[model samples]
Target: MLLPIFHFSAAAIDAYVFWYDQNYVDLPFKNPMVKELPLKSRCMFLTIWCLILQIAYHTVAFLNDVFGTNAASPKKKPTIRLIKDVLFSVAFPIAMYVSGAFWGIYAVDKDLIFPEHIAKLYPVWVNHVLHTTVAIFMFIELLTTNRNYPSRKVGLSVMSVFIGAYISWYLTVYFKTGTWAYPLFDELNWPLRIMFLLFSYLLVIAIYIFAEKLNYVTGSSKVEKNLSGKHKKR
Candidate 1:
C-alpha cells in the first residue's frame, strides 16, 4: 500500500516538475538541491506532511477526550496543546480547500485544453473524483466536529498564501528559464490569464464558503469539531 502510494505521489511530483520547468516564467532558486529535491523527494515529503497532519489531528482529539478540556486552553497537556494550537490555529486554514480547488481545476484543464501535445497521461476524471472524494471527507469530518466553523478571513488568507507562493515560485522559474506551468496560462493574452486567475480564485472561495454553509445547516459543524478534537490529539 505504501509503495504504490509513494510511486503515485512520485509520479505526480514529476509531472509537476515537468510542468514547472516547461511553463514556469521565473525560476526562484539557483540551488541545484532545491530544483532536484522536489523532483526526487517531493512525493515522500508530501506524503509525510499528510501523515503528520493525520497524526496530529488524531492526537489532539485523543488528548482533548482524555483531559476534558479544549486543546486551545493553555492549561492542557503542553505537547498536545501545542499540536492543537498549530493544527487549528495555523494549518487548518492553510489546508482548507478554497485555494486548492483552483489548482485542482487547472490540473484537470491542462490535459483537456492542450490534448494535442500534452498527451493527457493522467485521466482528468480521476483527478476530479479523487479531489472531490477527499474534499467531501474533510468536509464531513469538519461538519461533524463541534469546534469547526467557517471563517472568511481564514479562507481568504489561505487563498492568498497559496496564490502568492505559487506565483512567486513560478516567477523564479520564469526568471531562470523563461518558462511557465500549464501552457494555458502562458498561451492566453495577459488580460485573459489574469481574468482566469481571478475567476478561479473567486469561484474556489465561493465553493468553499458554500460547503461550509452546508455543513452548518446539516449540523456537521459541532460534530466535526468534536471529532477533530477527539481524533487529532495524541
Candidate 2:
C-alpha cells in the first residue's frame, strides 16, 4: 500500500520535472536530484536497487544473528565485526533513499514552492541527513555497548549506509546536472560546500554522543549486573 503510493508519487514528480526542464527552462537536475531519464528506466533502476539493498541488509543481518557470522556474534573476531559494521552502516541510508521513503513527501508535493528550486530535493536532503545521523549513532552504540538485538541495529545500519551514498549521489548530480538541490549549497562555492560537510559531520557527532549517553543509562543496569556475575564466578 505505502509502496504503491510512493511509486506513483515518484513517477508523477519525475514526469513533472521532465516537462519543466524541457518546456519551462533549462533547469539542472541538482535541485530535486532528478535526471533526464525516461520514467520507465528510472522506475526500473529504482526497483532493482531497492531489491538489492533489501536482500543485502537481510542477508547480512540473518547471518550475524543465526550463525554468529558477523558483528552480532559474541565469539566473532574484531576484524569480522569491524567489516560487518562498516558494511551494515553504509547500506541503510542508501536503501532508505531508494525505497522512496526519504523523498516521498517532496515528490508528492510538486508545488515548486517552499523548497524553492527543486521541491523534491529538500526532503531528500533532510531525510538523508536525519537517517544517516541516527543510523551512524546507533551503529556506534552497538559497537561500544555490544548490544544483543542484531536485527534493530542492522536495520539502522543499513539506513545509514543508504543515506551516505545518496548524499554522494546528489553531490555527483550537482556537478553533472548543475541543478543545485539546495540553494544554499548550490552556490558552487567551495567554502560553502566545505561548511555544509562540516555541519553535517558535527550533527552526526552530536547524535552519536546522545546515543552513547542513552545507552549508558539504560544498559548499565543490566550489563553491569551480568558483568559482575561473571567476575564473581572467576
Candidate 3:
C-alpha cells in the first residue's frame, strides 16, 4: 500500500518536474548548470540524465506495484523487475554522485558549480528538486524493493564505463564547443581537472560497491516470517 503510493508520487513528481524543465525557457546565464542558455542546452548535464532515469525507475515501480502485485510478492513482474534492477544500478549511484557532488561543491564554492547569478535565473526549491529529491526517492526504492545487485566486479565495471563515458562526453563537448559542461572545470587547471575526473570516477564506483553490500544486508533477502512468526532468510 505504502509502496504503491510512494511509487506513484515519485513518478508523478519526477514527470512533472521533467516536463516543466523541458518547457521552461531562460536567458543564457553563463553558468552551464543553469537551464536555458539556449534553453535545450540544460539537457547536457549529468544531473538531467539522472533525473530521467529516476523518472523511468519510479514509473516502472509504480506500474509493478499497481498491476503486478500478488499474494506472494507485492511487485515482481519479471520484465519490469529486470528494468527496475538495471535502472536502479545506474540511477542510484549516479543520483548519489550528482547530489553529493553538487552540494559538496556548492558548499565550497558556489561559483564553481552553481554561481550566485544562477540562483536568480531559477528558484531555490527547483535546485532541491533537481539535486536532492531524486536521490531521496532512489534511497526509498532501495529500502522498499527487493533487488538483485550485480556482482561487485560486474557492477564496478559497468559504473566505471558509465563514469568514463560522461568524462569523455564533457571533454568532447568542451573541445568541440569551447565550453565546459560544469563550472567546476572552469576553475581547474589541467592537472586538477585530471584529478577531479579521477575522483568522480572513484566516487561513483565506491557508491556502487557500498550500495550493493548495503542492499544485500538490509534490503534484498527473499524471505518472510513463518507461522511461528520468526523471520528467516532464503
Candidate 4:
C-alpha cells in the first residue's frame, strides 16, 4: 500500500538526484557563503542519509507486510518488526530535524542555509523533495502505523550516537573540503558556533523526546504495557 509506494518513489527520485548531480551543469549562483554547498559528498548531507533511510525503512516494511503474511498476516514477523522499529527510531527524528531546521533557517534567511540563487537557478522541486517530502512521508507513516517504540533511555542513547556521528562527519568534511555542509555553520564565530552546536543538540534531543511522547500518546505505549503485563504474569 503506502509502504510500497513510498519505497518506489524514494528510490526512483533518489536515482534521479544522482543523475542530476552528474548530468546537470553547474549552477549560476556565486557566493562565498553559498560555497559549493555543492553536490559533491551529497551523501555527507543528512538530507541524503534520511532519504536513504526512507528507502530502507519502507522497503523493509513493505516486505514484512507482503511476504511475512500468514495466519497472523497482519502481525509482523518478530525479526522484521525489530528491524523496522530500529529504522523508524533512527529515521523519523533526523528527517523531522532536517526539515524543521532547513525550512526555519530558509524562512529567516535563505543565505544561511539554502541560498536564494540556487532555488532560482534550479527547480524548486529539488529543494522540497529533499527538505519537505522526507518529513511529510514520516508524518504519514507515524499516523498510519502502530510501532513498538523503544524505551526512552534506549531511544535517546541511539539518537545521541547518531547525532554525534553526523557531527564528526561534517567536521571531517569541513576539514577536508574547507567548507561547512550548510552555510549556517560558516556564518557563526567560535563562541557562537559552540552555542549553536549546543543549541542544535538540545533541539534534536527535544525533537526526539517529543516524538517518543507522541508515539505513547498515539497508543503504542498501551500495546507495549499489555505485552509487559503479559510477560510479567508468565
Candidate 5:
C-alpha cells in the first residue's frame, strides 16, 4: 500500500512538472499531441500507468495477506502479474534504451535530437529523473521483491500490442499536426523511421528474453512463484 502510494506520487509529480515547465507556448487546438502531451509525447507515461496498475494489484494482494482474507482473486492475480512483468521487462527497457540513445545524441549535438529551446526546459537532472530514475527504481524493486513473469508468448503479445498502439498514436499525431511528436521521428526519413521502429521492437523482444534468463539465473524461481496459487514471499 505504501509503496504503491510512493510510485503513484512520483509518476504524478513527473507529469505535473512536464506540463508546468512546458507552459511557455499556447498550443494550437489542432495538434492533439501538444494538447495532450503526457499521453502522446513519450512511452514513459504509459509505462508509469502500467506501474500504477501493477502496484494496485500488489497492494490488494498484500492487504489480503495481512488481513487473512481472500480479497485478491486468483484470476486477477495472474493478469496483474503478467502486466507487471511485461511493463517492467519490455516497456521500461524500451523507454530507458530509447531515451539513453537520444540523450546521448543530444549531448553530442543538441540540435539533432532536442531543439535548443526545448532542451533548455529540461535540465540534466530533470532528464535523469524522468528517464533514468524510473528504470533504476523499478530494477531495484525487481531485485528485492519476488516477481512471477508470464510465459514468453504472453509477454511478447502484450509488448507487441503496447508498441503497436504507440506507433498508431504517433501516426495519428503526425496526421493531425503534419509533424512528428518526437524530434527523432522528424530527423529520420520514412525508411529510416520504419527501420528504427522495427529495430526498437526487436530490441525489446531481445530484452524480454534476457530478462527471463536473468530471472532464472538469479534464482527468482525459488523466491517468486507462479500465480497459479503457489506464491512465496521471502
Candidate 6:
C-alpha cells in the first residue's frame, strides 16, 4: 500500500513536471495530435494509471483491515481487486520490459529509437522512475500479499479488452496526428507494426501467466498454513 502510494505519487508528479516543462504550460502545442493531449498513448502514463488503481485497492483493503468493517461492498472489492491483479500482472510488466529494452539499446546510440534531442532534456533517473520502479513495486506486492488471481477466462477477457482499448487509442492518435505514439512504431512498416503489436500482446499474456505461477508458489503456503499459538483461522 505504502509502496505504491509513495512511488505513484512521485512518478505522477514527475510526469506532470516533465510535461509542464516540455510544453511550457501550453500543453495543446506539445504535439500536433488533434482532439487533446493523447496521454493514453504513453506507456509510462498508462503504468502510472495502473499504479493509482493499485493504490486505491490497497487503501480500501487497509481501511477494512484496520476498522474491522466491510465498508467496501462485496462485488466492488472483488472487481477492484481483480483489476489490480490484471494491472500488476499485465500492464506493469509490459511497461517495464518495453521501456527497459528501448533505453538499453538506446544508451549505446542516441538515434536508435528516441530522437537525439529528447535524450538531452532528462537525466537517467527519469528512465529509472518510468521503467524500473514498476517491477520493484510489483515484486513487493507479490512477495507480501496472498493475492487470489482471477480465473484464466476472466483474466484473458479483461486482458483482451485492456490491450484492445489501448491499441485503438494509439491507432486513433496516429490517424489524427499522422505520427506514431512511440518512435519505434514509426520505423516499422504496416505489416511489421501489426505483427509487433500482436507479439507484444502475446508477451503480456505470458507474463501474466508467470505472475500466476509466482502467486501460487509464494502465496499458497502463507494462505494455507496456520501460525503457532494463534487461532487456527482460515
Best by lDDT: 3
Q: Which stretches of candidate 1 lie over 4 Å from their true place?
A: 1-132, 221-234
lDDT value, candidate 4, whole model = 0.68
Give the per-residue lDDT of model 2 (tens digit) for 83-143.
4445444443333333333345346553321255543433553334332333343343243
State the displacement of the C-alpha of residue 8, model 1, in Å, after optimal TM-score superposition.
19
Cα lDDT tens digits, model 4, 65-179, are 5654211123435677667776788788888888998899888998988776656645777777778888887776665556766777888888889889878877776776676
Q: What are the root-mean-square deviations of the candidates from the true structure over C-alphas? A: 9.1, 11.6, 4.6, 6.2, 6.2, 5.7
Backbone clashes in model 6: 0
Q: Which is superior by lDDT, 1 or 3? A: 3
**Model 1: per-residue Cα lDDT over 33-141, one tens digit each:** 4455344322212222333343355445455445534422234345544444334433333334422643555567845233434334334543332233334434444
- lDDT of all the models against the reference? 0.44, 0.41, 0.72, 0.68, 0.55, 0.55
lDDT of candidate 5 over 48-162, digit per residue (tens): 3444334443444343334432222243454445445445555445555555656676678777665767566666765565556655655544543345566778877877887
Candidate 5 lowest-lDDT run of ten: 64-73
Writing each residue's lDDT as its tens digit, candidate 3 over 1-234 gives 566788889888877777777677353645454333333776567887788778888888777666553122334346766666666788899999999999998889888888766666666666788899988888867765676655667767767777778778778667757788777888789999999888888888788878877877763333222221443332
Comparing 3 and 5 by TM-score, which wins?
A: 3
How displaced is residue 61 in candidate 2, in Å? Answer: 2.0
Cα displacement (Å) at residue 148, model 3: 1.1
Backbone clashes (count) for model 5: 0
Winner on lDDT between 2 and 5 is: 5
Better of 1 and 2 by TM-score: 1
In Å, residue 7's CA in model 2 sits off its true spot by 24
Q: How accurate is candidate 3 locally (lDDT)?
A: 0.72
Q: What is the lDDT of residue 166 in candidate 3?
A: 70
